[model samples]
Target chain A: MIDRLTAFVDRLRQVGVPVSTSEVIDASTALSFISWSERSVFRSALAATLIKNGTHRPVFETLFDIYFPQMVGELQQEPDSEQPSSKNDAKPLDDMTSEVLEALLRMDLELLDRLAEEAIARYAGMMPGRPVGGRYYQWKVEQALDMNAITERLTQMLGGSGPGGETAGSVLTALLAREDATARMGELRRRIERIIRGRLISDRGPEAMARALSRPLPEEVEFLQATSEDLAEMKRTIAAMSRRLAARLAYKHHRTKRGRIDFRKTIRRSLETGGTPLEPKYRHRTNRPDLIVMCDVSGSVASFSRFALSLLYALSQHFRKIRSFAFVDAIDEVTHFFEQAEMEEAARRVRTEANVVWLDGHSDYGHAFSQFLQRYGDALSPKTTVLVLGDARSNFRDPLAERLHEIRDRVRKLYFLNPEPHRHWDTGDSIVSKYSPVCDGVFEVRNLRQLAQFIERIG
Target chain B: MFESPDRVTAALKKGGYLSDAEIATSVFVADSIGKPLLIEGPAGVGKTELAKCLAEALPARLIRLQCYEGLDESKALYEWNYRKQLLRIQADENKDWSKTEEDIFSEDYLLGRPLLDAIRSSDPVLLLIDEVDRLDLEAEALMLEVLSDWQVSIPEFGVIRAQRRPWVVLTSNATRELSEALKRRCVFLALEYPSIEREKEILMTKVPDMPEALAERVAEVVRAVRNLELKKSPSIAESIDWARSLIALGRDSLEDGEIAETLGVLLKHSVDIDKARGALTAK
Candidate 1:
């Protein structure tokens, strides 16, 4: 049990959950107090000890299913009232369809489990050592059972309200019945997936299945390779993370205000106390820097730029003075959008309303930098930190390193964030080499984790 | 004080808080192992209510420390009565300075906050630290120190240890990420909105006069509203309040007219109420 538990902890760490040694020990101690046969309580015990963040629960649950599966090899044949009563009488799918429907209507979970097992054994064709994914087996089982027709029939039968009556009470009754049916069918479908996963785990082992099935957390998904779902999830994560950062920043700002004690002031105030320095005064330091963020809203790294802009503006209240600009071929200051709306809405307005495109839509770093200096050059002072976000793909235009150098000399600090990998930095049309030497630091920020780290370091 | 997870569940149920098996197991383990349980969830999902229910179920005296921004050690843990100390020093001015200083710095001038009060109490205590995410870094570190060893260190007086280990429960709405050292000392539970069935059970338990069909309807409508993209979804308390309101108005069924009249009881925001009205009436 200890060996399996340690292996599970190792799997959790591999998938980005930082389970410490002490937490693992806590989980091990929790294991001895609960019954090992009860999976729900056992899972709760492990979850309470291992997981600290709420977003990591889904990943932990997936890894938990792979490690401590529902069943090992095959179903232990236990006959009960719901079984078809003839031990080996092998009935076909067409005949048992009504039994399955009956079980679903009654919402008998144990009966559904048995039916799911029989269905997987007979129709899924999941052989040992097969390299098929779990989704394929689930699809096969879904097709063999004709689940769509079953669901439709179940819905029709379970709709308790009469079709002719359209009163509000009857409508609510129908809605509740439909919801009940959907929940029961969802349970059945989940059981089928878990049973298939169990068989596959016994065949392919937990590690292989874990590697094949584990979905990347939103932070781990690269910004350049994110799908729409990943983008939506990343936006939510950014909103929450920025809120926390803003809280911490507010606390840090107050902590720094009470600076070192001024001995001169303390002694001056203690003149009435006969040379006893009774009250010490602290030197108040107000040193919050100004910020200017320039994002490249071109075709390639548009999502990355939007996410970066959203995160920066969400914590904009903490800065002394902050300004934002969006650019492609031309540059436009977009600090007003964030001031009037939410971050997501502000990002949307930047794409539609902002005049970021001039002749063509390709990114031109030289023209944008010169345009920034021409318009907002006076805005850059010794207290300003300028952040530039883009891929630096200038479309074979001017590789203007001097323009960035001029901006670098005007600001307190200059940082470049490239959404591309470090290897793809100096490739065709990419002028990262021209910009890297001019800035204080050039970082490859390809994912949310890297973006958050860069923001923390600069904030 | 509970014997097992089953007893904890039953006691919570009797105390008007219906919990699932997962929660029961966590509460049991935290009690047996003597660790603080940290509960994180969205607002109005009953995170603070769980701590209150645990205190009632245990029949222990509740000592709450409500956390907010700028909460510090002196306000949360303990503080020195400076005015009293000054008065004592002035009254005994002609005496020896060292003896007067010793008299002023003793336990007479010590003010015990909630954290210290729970630690020094002879009776059983359920220390509820509510909204712990609002605590800044320094107070959080102080809490970590006090929780790990169950003792508070005062510079003037020595360390004050716990007379009895209190059952600590910390609740957060997840507005900020708590420090990992504080989280490492506690067992964690991530609470979400309850299912429709559980909501119905809660309604029936809390408002005993509510009918079964009305309770189910309220639960289903609340679940649907929660699934909508509203700014603020209806919480579990809102659901129970809506049900009780229905019973008060002598209404047995939820129709369009009734919902339009009483929708404000469930949804606080006007935009959410408008959206919920459209969705609920459209069905």
Candidate 2:
């Protein structure tokens, strides 16, 4: 049990869950108090001790299923001679359709489990040492079961004459029954999937299953490579991340603002308080830097620019003054879009509403920089920090490094954020080296983690 | 003090908190292993109520420390009573300075906050740190020593160890991520909104006067509203409050009119109420 626990901890850490040594000890200690007979409690014990963050819970649950499965092999039910013919093991596939419908209608979980196991055994082609992904097995089982027909039959049985000849009360009853049927179908599907997953994990040692199944965390997913689902999840976390960033930035500012206590003031105040020195004063620090962000919203780096602008817009409360501009070959300020609507809406509006494109819509960094400096030259000051977000691919245009140098001279700090890989910096029309000398910092931020680290460093 | 997860479940049920086996198992393990339990979830899923229920189940004295931004050690852990110390110094004028210093820093002049009070209590103590994620990182760091070693050390004074280890339960709405070192020492329980059946059972337990059918209906409607993408979903507490309000208004069954009328009890936000109303009517 200890060996298995340690190995599971290793799997968790492999999947980016930071489980410390003390937590491992706590988990082992927690395991001793619970009975292994109670599987839910056993799993809960490990989860409580091992997992902390809520986002990591899904990964932990997946790894937990692979490590500590409920049943090892074909689950053995109690043998009953009285009802042998009706048993799932003896029943043929022809009778299974009705049996499955009946089991689903009754919501008999054990019967569904047995049916799922039997269906996988016959249909999933689960031979020893067979190398196949778990989803293929699940798809096979799903195909064999004809789940759509079963659901249609179940709905027909549940709907009861199609609610045509029903009263208001019976209509409500049918609606509730249909809802229950949909829930049961969902449960049936989940059970089949779990059974297939368990069979594969047992066949292909858990290490390989862990490798095949583990997904990159939302923060680790590259902005350029993110799916729509990943982008939605990232959007959901952006608000919370921004709130945390604001808190951390405010805390750091407060800490710096609290300078060392003045002994002279303390002594002066102590004269009135019988030399007790009860009240003390400190030197107050000042100045919050202004920020101006320019994002290149060309096709290649559009997603990266969207995320950067969304994060900055969400965190606009922390900055003293923040102005955001979106550009392709032309530059236009889109800060008002953020103020009028939410972050996602603002991102969408920046594309459709902002007049950013001029001539062909390839990313012409030289043209955009010159346009920005021409239009907003007076906006830059010594207390301002400017961040340019793009891949700096000038598309064989003039490699205008001097305009960036002029912008840098007017600002306290100038930084460039390139979403492309570091190795891909100066390839082809990429002119990052020309701008690197003028910029204070040029960071390669391909994913959310690096973006957050960069912001924390500069904030 | 819970012998098994089953016992924890039954005790919590009796204490009027209907928890599933998972929550029961976590509470039991935290108790037996002498580790603090960290309960995190969305707002109003009963994370804070879990700590109160555990206190009631154990019949222990509940020492609550409500955490917020800028809540530091002097407010949470302990602080020296400066006025009392000053009086002691004034009273013992011309006495030996070392003895006076030692006399003022003792237990009489030391003010014990909730954290220290829970540690120094003679009886069994259940320390409930409510909304712990609201605490600043420095204040959270201050709790690591007390949470891990069951002791607090002041530089001027010696280490104040726990007389009997308190069962610590920290609740977070997860507004901010907690430090890794603080989380490493504890057991974590992520409490979500209860399922429909569980919510029905919760309604029955929390408001016994409501009819079983009506409780089931209320749970189903709340679950449906929760499925909608709204600003704030109705929490378990809101469900109970809605149920109690239904009974108070003398409504036995949940007609569409009844739900529409009392939607305010379940949903706090106007936007959520409007969305839930549209969904409920369409259903």
The alpha-carbon lDDT assigned to residue A222 of candidate 1 equals 83
lDDT by residue for model 1 over A1-459, one digit each (tens)?
898889889988888888888888888888877778888989998999889888888788888898887665443333122234443677967777888998998888888888887787767776667789999989998998998888766766776434444332444445555666677789989899887777777767888999998787767898777777777677656766655554433444434436788888998866645556876867755456677889998988866776777666654533446898999999999988876455567888989999999879999999999998999899899877788989999999986789889999988889998899999988999999888889989988888777667655654
Residues A306-372 of candidate 2: C-alpha lDDT, one tens digit per residue:
6777666666633547788988888999877865454567788988999898998988888888999
Worst 10 residues of 2 chain B by lDDT: B274-283
Q: Candidate 2, residue A363: CA error in Å?
A: 3.6
- What DockQ results do all the predictions give, each relative to the true complex? 0.30, 0.39
lDDT tens readout by residue for model 2, B171-258: 9877677888989888999888998889999899889787999988888777767665555678898899999999998989776667
User: DockQ for model 2?
Assistant: 0.39
- List the lowest-lDDT window of 10 residues for candidate 1 chain B: B274-283
The segments of candidate 1 whose C-alpha lies over 4 angstroms from its true place after superposition are: A73-103, A143-185, A227-239, A245-252, A256-299, A302-360, A363-418, A422-445, A451-459
User: Each candidate's lDDT (Cα)?
Assistant: 0.80, 0.80
Positional deviation of B161 in candidate 1, in angstroms? 1.1
- The C-alpha stretches of model 2 lying farther than 4 A from their native spots are A75-102, A121-128, A143-185, A229-239, A246-277, A280-298, A301-358, A364-419, A429-459, B249-262, B274-283
TM-score of each: 0.79, 0.80
